[model samples]
Target chain A: MTLFDSLAIAWTALRSNLLRSILTTLGIIIGVASVIILVSVGSGARVEVEKQIASLGSNMLVVFSGSSRGMGGRSAGAGTDLPIAEGDVAAIRDKVQGVIAISGQLNGSGPVVNGNTNWTTTLSGVHPDFATVRDWPVRAGRDFTPQDIRASAKVVILGQTAVKQLFQDEDPIGATIRVKSAPFQVIGVLAPKGQSAMGRDQDDVALIPMTTARGYIVGKSQVQSDQVGQLYIKFDNSTDLKDAQEQIETLLRQRRRIQPGAEDNFNVRNLAETMKARTEVLSTMTYLLAATSVISLIVGGIGIMNIMLVSVTERTREIGLRLAVGARQRDIMRQFLVEAVTLCLIGGLIGIALGVGAAAIVANAADWPVVISPAVIALAMAAAAGTGIVFGYFPARRASGLNPIEALRSE
Target chain B: MNSVAAIIEASQVSAPVAPQSAAPALIRASGVSKIYRMGDQTVRALDDVSLEIAKGDFVAIMGASGSGKSTMMNLIGALDRPTTGHLAIDGRDIATMSSDELADLRNGTIGFVFQQFNLLPRTPALNQVILPLLYAHPRPDDLEARAHHRLEQVGLGKRTDHLPSQLSGGQQQRVAIARALINNPKILLADEPTGALDTKTSEEIMKLFGELNAEGITVIIVTHEPDIADFARRKLVFRDGKIIDDTERAPLKAATAAKDRVL
Candidate 1:
């Protein structure tokens, strides 16, 4: 039989029992829709996470002055011990290759007052290169000059959130704001940075010269007068991040005169490597979810196979009639196979519509990101067709193998 | 003819010879036996039965249930292969033919009409007639027109769009007859074709068969009813897997008024 004829015959047969045919496709529909919905949601989350990590700056590294193992063998987290200094920052810049920009940062939290409006926000102390290292640019007035840090200038840059809370739509640039009861002029307002991967508000902060923070605002450091808590480093595109990290570790160990087999009093984190690990985890989750969806598809295929078997049984006399009327065994097989494939294809198309609609609803209702790609849709269709072929083969073969005499004799 | 002369002539042709006419033998069965192993007890459905049916002949096979008549019909239709001995249809040995070749033989040379009408439910008459053509390789281009012509030939032209459920028993059988003739096979094999019909409907169907036979298409009908057998030119009675009685007579003529009226 021609393919068209087979399709027409299959369509007619399916239409004869329309309710049964539709019910048979339900499993496939649910399977395909779940696959699309879950995959889109999973990839959407991955993309959102990647974007958040990228916003922290490209090829960036953070060095914190805390021992890999603290006293009594308990490890201390980053930024716990404030022992990093200007000398350490200078040493890393001068000694390490590929260090495009480096800045010493000191973090503290206190209330900032502009007239009667007071907002408690994070205060960060940094060098003039902090803007380049963090990828945070001035949205309004000029950033601090190197001379400002050298002279312990009482100037600060306000973050977007800090600007809003303290200035209240007023231009905070060149306006003096009191930080911890000390008046400091806001030199610039930093551009908006949304949220961190850790779900913290990144824009609720203020930046000031490292020298000014150490001398005037933050008071004396516990370890030393010129102590900085952390160092932010930016690297050139050509730098291999792993090798750069290793070089910095070696340089610091040598400078501190640490003996072999002793835990170093510092930690260097490659932000890209951490983000890559996170991406890998996310993709693994996506595949796991996809694998589960595939199980449902197989279940759907089983549903098709079950219905097809029943159909063959119910239509045994019809098959015999066709055989007697000159339909070859292959013709019978083709008719049934085409019917199964048609069912799956119809289910898959419906599933695509349902999946996309559900994804859109999810994105709108829960504020979740959902991405649907053409490749995904195509894969889903191919999978549905394959399911038909795989599951339908046995039933079609059984139908074809039926003896004409016996089939005709069946009620 | 005298009774003695007729008896001598019948005895002379007791072995079922092909007619000495212009029409060639369409089906040749030699020593054909179909044995069925029914749960370890062997039942011979057809035992060493030999028969030759000439083209354009109307033959009726009359027998009770399990008398090998249906088995002979199936073998003639190429629906089953004999366990031993040869059966040929249209000059080809169907016993040795592959299943696909048998299908081709059935498609091009033989048509079957079942007792149940065997019409597909919910299918229009035209499409039912067009079904066999769907399986025809290098299928005829004038498919719908041929189906329409066959329907018209069976007096179902105006009912082409009526589904089987919407048709009367006699009309349904007519649609089946049209479907059987769609391929224009050399032989029409009807197995108990009138078994499901009332007497009037059966006569109308037999009349259609008579008209078809008159048009030079060989017709074979298997039925136990002698009344139905009276419509054919030749009758064979099968019992215990063998032909017990065979007779030849002039076919009963269909009435002229009934011939033209659509049932």
Candidate 2:
């Protein structure tokens, strides 16, 4: 028989037992749908992490002061070593080839008052360029000027949370707020920055000129004269951030007079690198889910084989009639094989629709971004056909091997 | 031979019949025996039987159940190979033929009809007749037209669109006959073609077989009813795997009787 005729015959047989065909396809549908859905969610998480990394700062690096060495020889928490000095910051700023911007900050918390209302909030002492290095654009008024930093003027920038708490419905610009009983003029309000990966409200702090805080707000320093606790640096967009971070670290080592082969006292943290690491983690999780779902696909394949076996047994007489009518063994084999592949293809099509629908629903319900790629659809379809061939062969061979006399006599 | 002589004497049936032709037999079976093994036991279904059926011959094999008549029918139909000895069709020895070759022979040279009509369910009459042609070597290009022609030839021209379930028992048998003739084979082997029909329908089916034989196709029927056997020019009787009687006589006028009642 022609291949077309064989396929037509296979379709007719499947149509005759509609309920059985549908039941056999259910397993495959579930397997493909679950695999695609899980993979999509993983991709969404990877994208979310990349966005978070970009939010922290693009092409940026944070240099922490050296950790303290205990008497027992183990390192202590960061900032225990000598704090970074203004001269060291200026040296790095002048010496690093790719250094585009530099700023220093000292962080602490205190009660700030406006009229009868008082709010306790963490405050930062920083250069005017700190806002640019951190990508924190001011929403209402102007940023602190160079003159403000040089003269150590008592000017301040309020974060969104601090503004909401102290100002209520009133405009905070040009208003006077008390910091440690010293009055500081509110210059601007930083735009709201939502939350960080650590679940902390990022917009819950204040900014002031570093020179003012060092001379008046924070009192004296123990580690060094005119030292800031942290240094923030930005590199040109086209320059590789890792290269800039390495050049900065090496310059710091030489300035600190650290011996060769000794562990560096300071640590450099790249937020982008951490985001890439999380992407790797998400990829591993997706592969694990794929493996588990492949097991389910095999189970679904087994279901197909079971149904095909039953169908062959029930149609023994029909097979004998075909054989008696001069149907070749291969013809019979191809007929059943076609039936199996048709079943899987149908199931796979339904599964693609289900998976896309599920991804959309989850995206809406959980408010998480989801992506459905063509690669996923192609993978699902190929798996379905492969499953059919691998599982359908044995039953088809059994059917082709049946003896005409015996088969006809069976009924 | 002895029983043949005895029946001839009792009926005083006409003078000894003349051989139809000098042409070689279309089917040749010599020393053929079929043995069945059911686990540890063996049953002899056909015992060293020899027979020849010439082209354009009409034959009926009659015997009760377990008398080995069905076994002989299967062997002649090329559906099974004899356990011992040789069988040939149109002078070609089938003893050494492979299963594939046997299938080809059945496809191009032999056709079979069953008692139950053996038509595929849900298929229309025209499509049913085209099934055998699908497996023919060099599969025909004009399949629908050929199937339609055969259905028309079988007097089913008016009901070609109806399913088998919509047709009468005799009509279903006619459709089966049309399927058997689709490949234009040399031999038409039928096993109890009217076993499921009423008496009047049986006569109509027997009449159809007789007409096809008259058109020069070799026809063989395996049946247990004497009245059905009356339509054949030759009758062979089997008992316990042995041919107890072989006789040939003038065929009765079954087609006329069929036309007088229902046609």
Candidate 3:
């Protein structure tokens, strides 16, 4: 018999018990729909992480001056002390071959006052190259000049978050903001950099010149005249990041007068490596979700097989009648096989629509980026067809092998 | 009923008997024995039965339940194989024929009718008739037309679109008959075809079979009712898996008169 005729026969058979057929395909529909939604959510998260990492600046490293081997060789928390000095920053800038820019940061936190508005925020004292090293640029007004750092000028740059809190959308470019009761002129407003990979607000700080911070804001507690809390370094490319890190470690040990057998007091953190580990964890989570959905799909296929077997039992006499009328074994096999595949394929199409719709809903409701690719839809279809074939074979084979006389005798 | 009128018209046409010496037997069973094993007990359904049926012949097999009449019907219909000896249908040794060849034989050479009027449930008469044609090799392009013609022959032309549930018992049997004739098979094997019908409806169905036989088709029926057997020209009585009586009856006119008397 022609395949078209077989399909028509299958269609008629399914239509005869329309409710049962639809219920049988429900398993597959839910399975495929879940697969699409879960995978899209995973891909969306990966995309968000990539954007967050990109915002952190590429090929960058941060050196914290806390003693990693504090007492009894125990490690101390980052930024606990001011061990990195202004001389160390200048030496790295002049001597480090692969380093593009370096800046010393003295971190502190206090309330900033503009008119009657006052907001508590972090304060960082940095050099002019801090903008280049951190890959952040001022969106309005001009960046701090080297003259501002050399003269300890009372000037400040507002981050986007600080600007929103202090100025409330009013122009803060030439306005004066008091930090810890010390007045400083705002030179620029830094561009908005949403959230970091750790979900920290990136634009919640104000930047001031290093000389001004050491002398006016936080200079009274300084043990050394030029000591800074941390140093931010930018490399030319990621290819030589490991080699450059090693070179800087060796140079720091010599400059800081650390003996060959003594443990280093500073810690160099590769932000790219930390972000790479995070990406790996996200992808692993995606795979786990996919695996769960695949299991559900297999269960759905088992449902198909179960229903098909029951159908064969229920229609034994009908199959016998067809066989007696002249249908070959293969013809009977094809009829049942087509019926199963049609069920799965129909369910698969509906699942694709439902999945895409659900993804759109999630994207809107949860405010997450969902990647719905054509390849995923195609894969879902292929999986549905394959499941039908795999699970439908045994039942179809059982039907074709029936003894015609016995089947006809069955009620 | 129109069935009586059709019967009267069918009886007027004399069926031509095949020339015995000139034509080969359409069915030949030589020393055929069918055995059934029920656990440890071995029962012989057909014990070394040998017979020959010619084309254009009408035969009826009569026996009680478990007397091997159904087994003989199944064997003749090629639905089951004999355990020993040879049974051939249309010159091909059924024992040696492949499953596909047997399927072809069943499709192209023999038609089957069941006692229950085995029309597909919820299917219209037209599609039921078209069922066999769907399996025909190089399936006829004018399938609907052929099914329509067959339904018309069975006096079901107006009811072609009616489902089995909507049809009367006689009408449903006619639809089954129409389905049997769709493939144009040479032999029509029926197992107790009139068992579910009233005497009037049974006579009407037998009359239809008589008309088909007059058109040169071999007709074989298994029925216990002697009145139903009277409709056929030849009768065989089965007892304990063996044929005890084989007789040739008078022509179609005698059976027609007997059916007229019942009406």
Best by DockQ: 1
Candidate 3 local accuracy as lDDT?
A: 0.85
Runs of candidate 3 with Cα error greater than 4 angstroms are: A15-26, A67-76, A94-97, A104-192, A201-229, A257-264, A346-369, B1-19, B240-242, B249-263
Best by lDDT: 1
- Per-residue alpha-carbon lDDT of candidate 3 for residues A1-411, written as tens digits (9 for 90 to 100): 899988888888889989988888888898889889988888888888888877877788888776755668566576555488888887887887778888888888888999899998888889888888888989899898999999999999989999999998699999998999988899999998889887878899999998888877775665367876688899887448787788788889988788998777787888878888888898898889888988988998999999999999999999999889988899999988998899899889888899999999999999888999888899999988888888899999999999999999899
> After superposition, which runs of candidate 2 have C-alpha atoms over 4 Å from their true positions?
A50-61, A65-85, A91-266, B1-20, B253-263
In terms of TM-score, the best-performing candidate is 1
Candidate 1, residues B85-132: lDDT per residue as tens digits? 999898888888999988888887888898899999889999999999
* Reference-based lDDT, each prediction: 0.86, 0.83, 0.85
Query: Which wins on TM-score, candidate 1 or candidate 3?
Result: 1
Expressed as tens digits, the lDDT of each residue in B1-263 for candidate 3 is 34433433343343333323324688999999999999999999999999888666678999999889999998888877899989989888788878777777788888999988778888889999999888888688998999999999989999989999999899999999999999999899998899899988888898888777766678899999888888887788999999999876455434555345434
lDDT of 2 at A62: 85
> How would the candidate models be sorted by DockQ, starting from the highest?
1, 3, 2
B67-151 in candidate 2: lDDT tens per residue?
A: 9999988878787899998899877777788888888888878888888888888889988888878887889899888878888
Q: List the residue pairs that clash in candidate 3.
A: none
CAPRI docking class of candidate 2: medium
User: Can you give the lDDT of residue A205 in candidate 2?
Assistant: 86
What docking tier does model 1 reach? medium
Error of 1 at B132 (Å): 1.2
